[model samples]
Target: MSLPITKSRFCISYSISKFSRFFPNPSSLSSFYSQSPSVDVHDSQPPSDDVQDFVSQFHSMFHMRPVPPINQFQKILGSLAKMKHYSTTISLFKQMELKGIQSNLVILSIIINCLCELGQMRCSFSVLAKILRLGYHPDVIALNTLMRGLCRNSDVKKALTFHDKAVAQGFRFNEVTYGILINGLCKGGETEAAIKLLRIVEGGLCKCNVVMYSPIIDSLFKDNLAKEAYDLVTKMISNKIMPDACIYNIMIHALCKERRIKEAKNVLAVMVKTYVKPTCVTLNILMDWYSLVNEMKSAEHIFNTMTQLKVTPTIISYNIMISGLLKNKRVDEAMNIFQEMPKRNMVPDRVTYNILLDGLCKSGRISNVWDLIDEMHYRNQQPNVITYTCVIHAFCKNYHLDKAFELFKIMMKKGIQPSMHTWNIFIDGMCKGGRLQEAQKIFQYLLIKGYPLNVFCYSTMINGLCKEGLIDEALTLWSKMEDNGCLPDTVTFEIMIRALFEKDEIDKAETFLREMILRGLMT
Candidate 1:
């Protein structure tokens, strides 16, 4: 055998008398057993073949011991991440550091990955500082891991900071890294910043094209910058960055918002004419667009076309159709669609109830509204704040103040504290019932209880008092309300005029009307 093998066999048999000036003999790992407690490193342990196999497999993965193997460290970090057990993972990384294994890029990458997974971007960045301070150069994978993870978790500020660091460290910020950062900026509603990042990256170091332009277009649409969004679409196609369904859908939404239905449809037609098959999101956006423009026929046509295409309508699709039917007063058909949701294995969510309830209430179908309440209870779907408020508003409108108060009380007792809308409904009921004093009492109570008094609430009470011949009280409250930041409107001035007229004080009424005119009212 080789001299190394001869040395290994001799080393296993007896202690060496001196250092050998010979071949590098691999250490006899079997001698490790005698130096310490015996270890059943092999699968010869019959009781636990599985555990023995695991141990053997682990040792076989990497041969070095002092450098606690990279895979085990990485696997531990991964499991912790998957479990979302961040604190424990952090502690383990600290332990690895204490063992002086000199965390490799892989170990550093995994730790940063875990930090980003937890959305602990601040912590991830702190680890980056540690990596740099240790004078250990991080590779592209390590830098990208931190960059991509931080951006994905919405820690865009730190992600960008790390991006600058990567560039400073001579790591190329490739398309994947830049794209992720742009996506994060758009999602965070920093459209200007996203555009700036895109501009900074156009030095031919990177080949950014139309794919980069989509998010900027989408962001413009999201911020209601429709004109800007429209301009970008033309710019994109001219630049040869072909518009996909997403880009087209975003434009369609913006155009529909502006009531430019024809232009929006042309975009959709372009999408359909191309290989870009209309997706559910596209169809839903179109349906919403048509509904918003009150082009009911177009909306219905799209719905029928979607069904003919063999693409099953999602819950959102069904809800939009039901809302359209109800808006057109096709109550029975709307109810049928609502009832048929479960047969397709789709259960109604909060939006479904909200659409139905709003429709019924708007149509003054209070009896149907009550039926929905019962249905909600039967289906174990507890009425939310909006549901309770809508029903109460309906009751208040019909002068059924007693029923409204009962439901409002029950809603409060159920820990669904009355929202501002709920309070506004009750105030309206009090106003209609000529219970101005009671309304004022509740107003003061709501203010004292720290429930914010919206302008609507303040206006309602001011009008109620002015109409009740409580002009002096109304005037004082109006001044105090303004001092408390409640804005007075044209109706508020009109009510003040009426209150002055109630006292047959024509001089003050005309004087105040002139002041309102100076304030850009009564024009």
Candidate 2:
């Protein structure tokens, strides 16, 4: 029997029972966590263990005692919220509904928050509607939660409009309300509007804080307004606010991207003078820029400097170094650094393996690829689509079609769905190997499966038919692809033109040449 009494009562109740031990009564709820829970309740997720314990306690208290007061349910919801157990919080809220506990702003706010976090904004608005129906205007916190939720879902324009109407209705706004709008605007690539909002803060509309300022400064830097960003930082400092490492790193990265390494170094010097310690991100960006500019010597100097400063290189740092080395064709040095990663207690992620695999494949070190594959399994890392694609591409490139097909089957059997790129690889490989019939079968399967047939897929198939002297079939496929709304690209047009020329169909080829010109697709 599910505690909430839904249709699948047995299944629901069994699910509730799993965490029933953590259910809290009014008597036990106050001292549950040593730290008093937050009221803001947005994204304050507790660790998994704490969450599990809270669940167990809630379940116990619910079944053992008479139903607690509504306030007690609110407290439990808040705690579940801090744990980010949103679904569980909603479930418990439904259970509260079943017990005849009337909804109050406190409980409704918690529900609204969970709905927002779950990206069910319509449901959150419905909860807001319920609060209004019960003659309770949502507090600023509740309203802010809704606005932030809209921002998170990338509905910044809607959030802006919502806030504007609320203000028109005489709902007073706070710093948090403004902050949410500013953050939303900056993230949505409307930094100009965000800067204008920050000016409102400067005019004493609201007190400025780091949270409101940081994103605008970062966005300014992103828009290549480095001087303006620095000017804003200066203003912040004038107001006795010190810039954090994140802001400094943004400046460093912007400078590096513009290849103004000297200016980036100047910013680093200022950071050093201010006693702001450089992070791995700071070092990695510098190293990445140096390597990209073919200045490996400078990159190595920074790598060595990190060791001297007692700052441990993160996996990202190592990955950057290895990638830089591989691009410079220093394969041996790349391998050595990869080997050193384990010594630093760093586990290699998929990117790390992919880089090494690419380098090995390019160098024709096929035997070493399997060794890395075995090591990936040992480390509990499953090879993803990119991993399989890399190996398949290598096999196809090396004329190992049988091996490529074998691996393709293995990936599918393991439930790794082949991406369009994967299909293209096999199709192109078959076409190159003069296996036109096999390529045609794969093309037919793609159509039957209703996978999006892109220009490359169509071009590859048409090219295969042309190679086999089947001009009529190729032309039919071309017409079919166009009818299916797959717009032909330059390569597709060129393929058809060449095929028509080969078959002495000069008039049809001229028509296509004119059509290509009309579409502005000719290179």
Candidate 3:
């Protein structure tokens, strides 16, 4: 497919002299847009029935005796692009070009957007060049797409340069242009530059909106310039540009990160007072923060407030409360929340099950765990490695080594790859259950399989040996651990030093103690 060379009313005569610096040879890029390249088009078809049917209709229109209007084709392409079927959009555009359909700025802009989304920046720019070559002036949307493509690729500097050069060449950009640049600057860690740009835009270049202010404010907080971020919020409000829920969330999250809960609450109060209704995200952030800080009462208050405000709590809301209650050892309250979830039409996710399982295991409420696991199965929520490990840990703590081993075997049989922590738990369990020989066998197996055995792994085996009065064997393993490039940590040395002292090996104990001190593991 080729872009029609004929000039239409949509075409404009413009010079490519300024853009020449970015693309050294405008003519060289012509071949790129003249036809889609022979490279493999990695387009994944959208699964929507409606989209598929629309695509079918689009393909059928291509075979029509008198083809559909260009705007009709543009509409189809635009719809596909809007649905994020970027690859499909590009492919369909190529087909239209092959069919000799006349292209316009709107159609080319869609192609540019698709290329940008697909990270084909080079091709996206080539399309721009084709627009200029065809005597069609590229609109701000097209220019913004290119800038955004550059920013998405993390080449914000190039985007900034493009912006300056475009402005110098008498191209008037709008708020969308500045928004793209500001977001790029913020993401690239040029918060200061972004703020300066915001100031410039605020001073009559374009009316600064929340889109431009949000990124700068967020960047300020991330850079630990909280006061500046808050000041920008004030500036935004004073300019009569009300902060959205997103901005409020950013402020509250930042304050929470700094452990300024009171300040965060004050911001939330301000949001409510302004009649800018808090979104689910706004309350979720506050709920999560309260949970994290163990302020269960405050968390409960937020939870209650959500219902009162008619903002339905999401599954995440329930999960956060359950997790917080679990952490604070209020397992019963967590269970109550878990039970209330289904009543609220909130189905518990794997995370909810895992949290409850872990809490029950830690609380030694093993009897309740089996029923929960059964419920998880009934809900089609298969227990993951974490779930099995929690139960195994509980069993090991209760000296039910056989039961722990049984669960471990079940996990492996179900194709669940145990994590290093899981392996450590089982090995420690065996060692504590006087199954040192079995523990040693597993450790050796892990070594032979080239598992990344950590210091804890080695220390666990060493402690088991020392407890079994096998000091010589423990020392030999310690030497092998070092040889394998696993350095002994403070706990490892502490185990050895204490073992040596208990065995009346004074000289060896003193030597390890001194080494520990020299290594800064001890004062």
Q: Could you say which candidate leads in TM-score?
A: 3
Candidate 1 residues 1-523, lDDT tens each? 1011111211211113221211122232222112322232321123245434533553454446555557776765565545555444555556555445456666666677766666655556556556666787776666777767766776566566555544544667567666777777787777887776666555454767666778888888878787887787787677677888777777777777777878878877888788777788888887877776667788778887887876678999889888888888887788898999999898887779988998888778888877788888887788899999888888888887888888888888989988888898899788877777778788889989988787788878888887777877888888888888877888788888888987998998998899899999877
RMSD of each: 15.1, 11.4, 7.0
Q: RMSD in angstroms, candidate 2?
A: 11.4
Tens-place lDDT per residue, model 3, 283-364, is: 9998999999889999999999897898999988998999999999998899999999888888999889999999989988
Per-residue lDDT for 241 in model 1? 71
lDDT of 2 at 263: 90
The candidates, ranked best first by TM-score, are 3, 2, 1
| Stretch of 10 with least lDDT, candidate 1 | 1-10
- TM-score per candidate, in order? 0.71, 0.72, 0.82
Q: Write down the TM-score for model 3.
A: 0.82
The lDDT ranking, best first, is 3, 2, 1
Q: Which portions of model 2 show Cα errors greater than 4 Å?
A: 1-50, 63-83, 89-114, 122-143, 157-174, 224-242, 307-313, 339-345, 447-452, 458-523
Clashes of each: 0, 13, 2
The model with the greater TM-score, 1 or 2, is 2
